[model samples]
Target: MTALSEYERLEAEGIWRPDPEAQRQEVILSLGDATLVIADDRSATALAHWSLPAMIRLNPGARPAIYAPSAEPGEELEIADETMIAAIEKVHAMIEARRPHPGRLRGALIGGGVLLLGAVVLFWLPGALVDHAARIAPQAKRVEIGRKLLTEFTKMTGQPCHSPAGDKALAALAERLPGQQVIEVLPEALDGARLLPGGLAIVGRNTIAGPDTPEVVAGFLIAAQRGAAGERPLHRMLDWLGPAAALRLLTTGDLPDDGIAEYAQELVQHPPERPNNDTLLHAFREAGVSSTPYAYALDPTGESVLGLIEADPFKGQPAPHPVLEDAQWVALQDICSAH
Candidate 1:
């Protein structure tokens, strides 16, 4: 095995802090493609090693594990058959593409592995990573992120529907949405709507205030939920940000200040390629909103959404009551829009 020159360089530069009182320090090993580096950081020795394509770290208290690219499917090593670690491995494979240089690649992979460990501790281990995130994420920051996203969603569709009617309609619909969910109607989004992690959804006020009724807005909400349930808004978010930021969200529960802008832009520009109809159907039925409204909103040509309405999930069922009261709707309608 060749010496990992890159790792050696980083160590020489004091990038690899060897904590003798900490635990073990095995020379880093790499996966076959050299996309990731695995280190046994449980020991205290400093015998530096080269990189490999795949490796595992075994700490006495930690779960025995393997960190392979997601491409290496199936259980590499059965670590109590934990699903979260499996999910993490799969995600790693999905994101760990071949880097240009072995050295930098080694650095990124190892760094990612450490971050991965952090995420596992933060999210998958046992406690509530989502709740932790909520607590950690400032209300002011969340609201700010929400406002900027509203601005971007508006800019993308070129539909300035800041009219009172549109605002009123959005208020009515917002009242009916889930309390845990973050719902906002922008004056844009002519083409599509999006749901994000942390209980947030964005749509064009036009989507809500178009010829369609409040039921349609409700249907779109269901569809967004369906999309989120299938792949988790968090996964979609992490996918957009790449794994590094995803890892940060998992641990710290907050992204960089600019991360929200990047996420909002991606949400506006990139709609979900395929939202599962079956899931959407269930969501619609559960929400008591007819699928027709949402279907038409997706495509007014009646070609795409027409079928959804025709084969309505609840048929004559009415959607549940609003998340906000009539007055709350009015208040939200004017929320920051006056400026």
Candidate 2:
């Protein structure tokens, strides 16, 4: 369903052959809730609707891929557009992944029987379920959950800060961190950076305000990445919501809106988690950023963060890459000014 939402209202043109003997004809194809609709080009009338889950692709890797409703003899559709082909493949993959796998169920049943023999099953089942759900969740589902949580977060923190120049600067910063999707700056309500589901990272205005260098901001980003890698955001949510919620998510690729809203409130009230010194140092070193600025910002006297200061990666030498140019840094600093 999340995959459908991502590719909703997508339409493309393709050549359709009604049968083996018929000539190919142009048709407009559109994606439905759970079907692929073929429409007549001129009249815009539906010609055929194929169940997406039941659709079959004939050509595995050839261009201008051919498809039929199923293995049965039927009309064939030939599509050459890469976007449409990718969309269909993605939707089918999501559907296939959601189906119950006999092998997996059999393994689980065997494991359950073994656990039943033990006295500590109750204490262990919940954690096992949460871990299983987190491990199996697809990237698309994680993105959907993150987007929903961000919407709820906005109710308390207000919309994310945005300015033309600031947005460009943020994009440039994101480019430095491989696999990072988006960096959101909240004008208020956040103390520092927190990683959401997917690759989203949220930070507070304090991260960029008052004598803060781009290195400090980069440090926060690195810390967020490390935290997310250590514990997946989905795992955190499932642990908070309990076993029933995790089971529901496994069956249906969604969580209750009310539960997510409650979690958002809880997140806004607490300080974001921090990674250990070793993890933080590793991230900073890999990113080619100095940790001294961020360490000093955490503790002005540098008493508590002495490790970070003493072990700064680029302490005496210059950074291999600049976090941001002077102009971009100026724009990033003023991201929350209008808000």
TM-score to native of every candidate shown? 0.46, 0.63
Q: How far is candidate 2 from the true structure (C-alpha RMSD, Å)?
A: 28.9
Error of 2 at 167 (Å): 0.9
Q: What's model 2's TM-score?
A: 0.63
Q: Go through the candidates in order and give each one's C-alpha lDDT.
A: 0.52, 0.85
CA-only RMSD, every prediction: 24.5, 28.9
lDDT of 2 by residue, 1-339 (tens): 223667647888988887888888899999777888999888989889888899999998899989998888869999988988999999888888889999999999999888785745577777888889888999998888988988988888899999999999999899987757889998878877777787777888888886558988888778767774477678888888887788888998788889999888887887557888988998889998999998987889999999999999899987999999989999999888898
How well is each residue in 1-339 modelled by candidate 1, as lDDT tens digits? 212322322121111222324433233333223333334444534333323334342322356453322343331321333443343354345445643578987999999999999999766743344444434555565655555555555556543435455456554565566532555555544444676555567665554334325565566666666664466565555555555565576566556657767776677666676466776776666666677766766777878665577778665665455434556444444543643
Q: Which candidate has the top score in lDDT?
A: 2
Off by over 4 Å in 2: 1-121
After TM-score superposition, the amount by which residue 76's alpha carbon in candidate 1 deviates from its true location, in angstroms, is 54
Q: How far off is model 1, as Cα RMSD?
A: 24.5
Q: Return the lDDT, model 1, position 92.
A: 43
